[model samples]
Target chain A: MWLLKLAWKNMWRNRNRTAITIAAVFFSVILSILTNSLQDGIFDNLIKNVVSFYNGYIQVHKQGYWDEQILDNTFEGTSALEDSILALENVNALAPRLESFALASSDTLTKGCLVIGISPEKENSITELKNKLKEGEYLNEQDFGALIAEGLAKRLKLYLHDTLVIIGQGYHGAMAVGKYPIKGILKFGSPDLNDQMLYLSLPAAQELYGAPKMLTSYVVGLENPSNLDPTAEILRDKLGNEYEAMTWEEMMPEVVQHIRTDKGSLVIIQGVLYMLIGFGIIGTLLMMMVERKYEMGMLVAIGMKKRKLMQLMLIESVFTVLSGCILGMLASIPIVFYLNRYPIKFKGELAEVYEEFGFEAIFPTSTNPEIFLTQGLFVICMALLLSLYPIVKIARLDPVAAMKK
Target chain B: MNTVIDAHQVSKTFNPTTIPILAVNNVHLHLERGEFTALVGPSGSGKTTLLNLLGGLDKPDKGSIFINGVDITKLSPNALIDFRLNNIGFVFQSFNLIPVLTARENVELIMQLQHKDRREINERVETLFREIGLEDKLDTRPAQLSGGQQQRVAVARALASKPQFVLADEPTANLDSKSATNLLDIMAKLNQEENITFIFSTHDVRVIERARRVITLVDGQIHSDTAKVSTEVPHTAQKRTP
Candidate 1:
């Protein structure tokens, strides 16, 4: 107890030096936490944007449908399958979709387009589809019209209430043909989806394709997206060999690869940041050891064991480093929370570039408590590792020589 | 003889592998309990080196030091430190009180290191402070105290653990004449009342004058050893055989 008191008092003997060391640790912690939080935030936001935009968190489809996305591979939509899935934990809602390709024509123009038939209200609950509407009204269950993408509308030179025609091969070599008025025009953040996409009511699409009561896939919405992988595994097991359930990560290998590549670069940057923090702490501790040489010698000469002296120094350093880390974490809480609430929105060319890549141009910070705890712990460990300098110095110190100065 | 410290044929050489300098050579000395002694010497005459050897702060290249009947030279480094803590005390030329601790804490530190009972430590510290005549300065840190007061605290610290003897290396070198005299008076009073042995290495005549016996060194060898019989000594001083 006396040694502890002495160590505490000794740390403040040079108040300016101690304060400077603490400040260095404090700022390093804040910078590290901010960097980690921002990195996690940006990646999470990208995944959320992609998932909610179209794919949902998990999907269930006929075993051979994803490999060959033709009308012949469509499965019958069963209420039992949907109920069994919804009964599982974290499964919020499921929207059954029939997807295929067709030639969309309007008077003078024609283009190859991807067509998706969806239950209007169920799809809206999962993807918030109605929020993307830029003109006219949303589709209903009995509607005979289609919703056309804004870019596709421009490509075909068509607007609301225009008669659009689609022609494609239906199940088992049946001729598929449909003519319908455009009920709404929707804008999508993804340039690829915006350029060649159209949505029709489930009944209208089934009638045109000559495949009634059929679905290509069941898009499974989740109450908690983080549980996507485990839930998908459970769904896959429940559905047996006839069907396959895949998480978004499995369905979109390109997106997962992009994230992994970006994370690799982020790791290098974070390593550099940690290196800087290590050097800062080492430098401060080196200065402290130099300045206290005489005092340490005097203590040893006065019958204090070298081990005891080292312990005193360690305790003193821990006090300083721990306080700095805790304060840095507390100070960062508001900044991280504020950034998470009001993300930084990009402007002008940057915004256009993000849209061209099918992403939002905003940057946000994550408010996860784990980020603060882990980053703070890392910095503290670095500081403690640097503190070994004093212990080694004390171990090798010659009290008679050190006392000379 | 009630000898507390015994040294024979002691020698210390600095930079043995390089330019060798013999700091203390062939020094022989014995200190009895309650004796106030001085090692007087010119610059580079090995007074401080010999004092260091006696205090177990440094090892002698040859010979051995025995304090309280234990051969300190034969002890390991860790054992030497523990031995020093339990058996010896030290006061440096610079009045090296730990600057961060209060005068009371500075004095209490040795007793704490000795693992003394809390009540005993407090009582000992209070008594030492009072004996040093700095009772009111107990709460002041070393920086806030005068040089003389700081040295008194150092002396109090030295006596707190009730060691066999105290080794002081030029304890008055940095103090003014008045402070030096005041410090000497307190040390002399302690020797008379408590029979606490004190051995100092000094170039100061004032310290030499108060010492009951004086040993002079030159060229790292003891030149003269003399004992004084004072007629003006206090009655309490008669309790010890000098």
Candidate 2:
């Protein structure tokens, strides 16, 4: 108890020095927490944009269809299968799509494009497709009119209510051709998707393709996208071998790889930051040891063992660092909360670059408790590791020579 | 007379490779219980080095040092620290009390290091502070206390563990005449009344004049050893009640 008191008093002997050391630790912790929080928040937002905006958290397709993607490989969209999946917990909505590549032609331009068929109401519930309409109106179940993307309309020089022809190969080597008026023009954040996509009602597409009651894949939405893995497992088990269920992470491994690579680079940056923080703490410790050389010698010469002295120094350092960590955490809470609520909007080139990748150009901080706690613990461990300097120095101190100094 | 400390042909050298300085030559000495002795010499004559050797603060290059029959030079570094904590006390010329601690806390530190019971530590600190005329300044830190007061606190801290002897290295070197005299009086009284042994290394005539025995060093060897004849009662003959 008295040793604690002594350590406390000693730490305050040079108030300015102690305060500066503590401030260094405090600010470093805040920077580290904020950096990690912002990075996590941005990645999470990216996932929501790329996956949940339309791709769905998980998808079910015919076993050979994913590899071949031909109309002959399509399966029947059975009510029993839909009901079984919907009955399982966490399955929010499902949209069945019949997709194929075809030639889209207008007055002067003929473009190779992707043709998609959807049930308007079911697709609306899952992907909120109706809200993406930039011109005219959303599709109805019986309507044979097509929904063309804004980029594709601009390339074709077509207007709303313009006639367009879609030509493609149908199932079993049948020739597929269709003529429909453009009912709507939809906008998309990604230029790749916007320049090539076309949507039609399910029955209209089945008639044109000459294959009734057929679907390429069922896109399944979930209550939480993070729960995709376990939900996909349950769905796969119920569906048996005819179909394969895959999460977005598996279906879009490129996106997952990009996030992983970025996180790896971030780890290296954080390691450098930690090294700077460690060296700052070590510098202060070295100064402190030099200043208290005589006092340490006197204590030892008066029969205080070196181990006891080492213990006292260790206690003092821990107290200082823990105090700094707690203060840093307290100071960061409000800043992080405010930043999360009102994210920083980016403009100019960066905004355009983000739009190109189909992400919102805003910076948001995460409010995860783990970010604060794990970062705080990491900085504290660094402080403890730097304390080894004093321990080794004291253990090897020559008391008689120190007293003379 | 019981020998409290025995030094057998002790020697110490400094900068042995370049300008080899023999700090303490081969010398033999013995101290009895309850004796107030002083080692006096000119500058660079190795009085302080000899004191360090006898107090176990420095090791001898050539011979063994025994305190109460245990050869301290043979003990490990950790064991030597334990030995010093229980058997030897130290007082420095600059009054080296830890500046961050209060006078009472400084005195209690040694006893605490000894792992003494709380009640015993409190009792001993109280008595020693009072005995050294520092009871009024018990809570004062060294920085807040005068030089004389700091030295008194140092003395009290040294004796708090009730060691076999106290080694004071020029304790009065930094005090004014009045403060030095007062400090000497306190130390002299403690020796006479409590039968505590004190060995000091000093160039101060005031301190040497008050010593019952003086050992003078010249060129790292004892030049003369003399004892003063007392006209009054031998102070140690009078029994003290604690």
Candidate 3:
């Protein structure tokens, strides 16, 4: 108790030095929290974007369909197939797709496009497609409708009720043709996906594409994406060799690979942040140690134990560092949330870079509590490490030489 | 009478070069339970070194020092600290009060070291400061106090824990003659009334006068140990003819 008083009093003995040191720790913690939070938010957004666009945690398909993606090789089952999947637990949203590649023409502008036939009533229950429409009404059951990507519509000079001519290799390499009026234009999230996608009713697309008994894939969303791998494995075992189950990670291997490769570089960034934090904390701790040197000497010379002096130094350091780190974290929570809600807008070339990478031009964030906790833990740990040196130096100080000052 | 401090042929050597420089050479000493002893010497005479060895603040090259019948030399660094906390007090030439602490708080430092309760420390601090004429200055930090007041605060700190021995290293060196006289008078009173041992390493004749016994050191060895005329009796200044 006596030593605690001394340690407390000793910390404030040199006001200028102590204050500067504490300020260094405070700013270091703040920078660390901000950088880590921003990075966490960015990474989380990347995953959410990819998941929303195509793969919803898991996808079920005929074993060879994923590799070939032909209209003939699809799992064509109704409620029974869905029941088998739903029986396994945690199947949140299931979307059945009848897919084909076709050349769409309007005013002599002909471009190859992937037309995915969907049931609008079921698609809304399965994916975010309903919410992605930017023009007119969504895919309506009453109309022989089609939802084309915004970019594809722009290229075809299309609008609602504008006829689009679709030509494709139908059943058994036979030519098939269809004329469809665009019911809606989808504001497709990924720029790449937007340029090539077209949606239609299941029955209309089956007859038009001449694949009356085929379905290309089943896209399933889960309540928790973390169960993706386990759920895929379970479905593969139950559905057997005739059908293959894939997680979102497998559905977009390129995106997964990008994240994996980025991990190495991100570690380098974390290291740089830690080093920057180290300098701030260490600089402050060094000053704190220096200011206390004389007091340490007196304590030793006057009958306080050397070890007690060391303990006093540690107590002083931990108090200052933890207080600053906790305060910084408390201040960061709302800022992260507000930023997450209204993402940072990018402009010009920067927006182009994001679009090229199939992401929104806005720098999206995830306001996860883990990000703040992890960052605060790192800063406090760093402060504790920086503080250890002074305690060690004090324990070994020579009282005679110390008192001479 | 129980001896508060007992030293046997204690030596402290510093290596200035290839040859060892003997700081305190084979000095044997004892302070009885209530004795007020002074160690007087010129500069570099190792007065502070002897005091350090007695306080367990520094290690000696040879011999053992015991305080309150415990052999401090044999104790580990940590144990030595525990020993110091419970057994000894110090008053430095510079007063050496932690500048951030109040006058009473400085006095309470030793009691805290002894693991005394806050109320006990506070009560003792209040009484000690009041006794030393610092009752009104109890809450004033060291920097706010005058030199004499700071020294008095230090004196209060030294006695606050009820330590067996108080080692003062030239405690009056920085004080004005009048302040020095007043400090010595208070210390002498404490020694007479409370039977608390006060050991001073000083060149100050005032301190020597107040001490019941004077141990004179020359070249790190004790030159003489002479009993003073009486307690509270000031030493007559004999003008040395140049």
Q: What is the C-alpha lDDT profile of model 2 across A200-319, one tens digit per residue?
A: 998988888888899988999788767778899999999999998888888778889878998999899899888878988898899999999888998888888999999999988988
Question: Model 3 misses residue A197 by how many Å?
Answer: 1.4
- Between prediction 2 and prediction 3, the one with superior lDDT is 2
Cα lDDT tens digits for candidate 3, A1-405: 666777677767677766776666666666666666666667677776667566567888888777887766766767888888877777777778888889998977999999888877767776778888898788764346788999999988888779898999876676778988888888876787789898888888888878775678777867777777778888899999888888877778887888778767877977887787688767777766676577678887666776667688788877677767777777777777787788788889988998988876765556677777887787777778777888778868887777786
TM-score, chain B, model 2, is 0.93
Instruction: Name the regions of candidate 3 deviating beyond 4 angstroms.
Output: A1-9, A141-143, B229-242
Candidate 1 residue-wise lDDT, A1-405, digit = tens: 988898889889889878887888788889888988998898888877776678888889999888888999889999998999899999989999988999999998999998889999999999889988999999998789999999999999999999999999887789999998999999886667788889999989999899899999999999988887889989988999899898889888888988899889989998988888788778878888888898788888888899999899899989889888999999999989999999888999989898788778888998999999999998888878888988999999989989996
lDDT of 3 by residue, B96-178 (tens): 88887888777776776677888887788777877798789988988898899899998998888788889999999999999
Worst lDDT window (10 residues) for model 2 chain B? B233-242
Model 1 chain A worst lDDT run, 10 consecutive residues? A188-197
Report lDDT per candidate.
0.87, 0.87, 0.79
lDDT of 2 by residue, B92-195 (tens): 99998887888998898898888899999889988998898877898888889999999988899889889999999999999999999999999999999998
Instruction: Sort every candidate by TM-score, greatest first.
Output: 3, 1, 2
Q: Extract clashing residue pairs from model 2.
A: none
Interface RMSD of each: 1.0, 0.8, 2.1
TM-score, cand. 1 vs. native: 0.91
